[model samples]
Target: MNEERIIELEIRQAYQEDLLQALNSVVAEQQKQIGKLEETCKLLHDKLKSLARAEPSPGLADERPPHY
Candidate 1:
């Protein structure tokens, strides 16, 4: 009975190790994706900033229709 119990424990440990490795891989992949998304957001933010600086800010609310 003791030998059987040891074998069972070993099997469980192996499965646990495999699961842990799979989880680690998934976490690593997610981290990489997060980094890419952050970089993309930064780039878009910079582009928007540049565009805002280049555009003229005309007040549309103060203008009346040409027909009036």
Candidate 2:
């Protein structure tokens, strides 16, 4: 009965270790994806700024000067 209990405990420990490893891997992947998304957003923001600098946007009818 003691030997059986030891084996069962070992199996549970191994299972828990495997689960922790899998969770770590998932978190790492999510972090990499977030980093990539941030980079893409920054690039897009830069592109928008460049475009705005290159040309004026159209809707300026009710205009106010800097003094206003």
Candidate 3:
């Protein structure tokens, strides 16, 4: 191959490597955000569960409204 062709190939390879690194950084950041979201979901779920357990049921089936 000619020298010009070799230089072009090298430049293309360098650009590809830079693009790959940028994509990896973005993916890592997304993973961190996802981890935080999962933890928040779990905490919300646990809070809701605790609230449900603490509150007594209204037992509407056994009672009648004032309008009745």
> Each model's TM-score?
0.82, 0.71, 0.80
Off by over 4 Å in 2: 1-3, 60-68
lDDT of 3 by residue, 1-68 (tens): 69999999999999999999999999999999999999999999999999889996678788888998
Superposed by TM-score, candidate 2 places the C-alpha of residue 36 at a distance from the truth, in angstroms, of 0.9
**Clash count of each predicted structure:** 0, 0, 0
In angstroms, the error of model 3 at 30 is 0.4
Give me candidate 3's TM-score against the actual structure: 0.80
Question: Best candidate, lDDT-wise?
Answer: 1
Clashing pairs in 1: none
Name the top TM-score candidate: 1
Give the higher-lDDT candidate: 1 or 3: 1
In model 1, state the lDDT of residue 14.
100
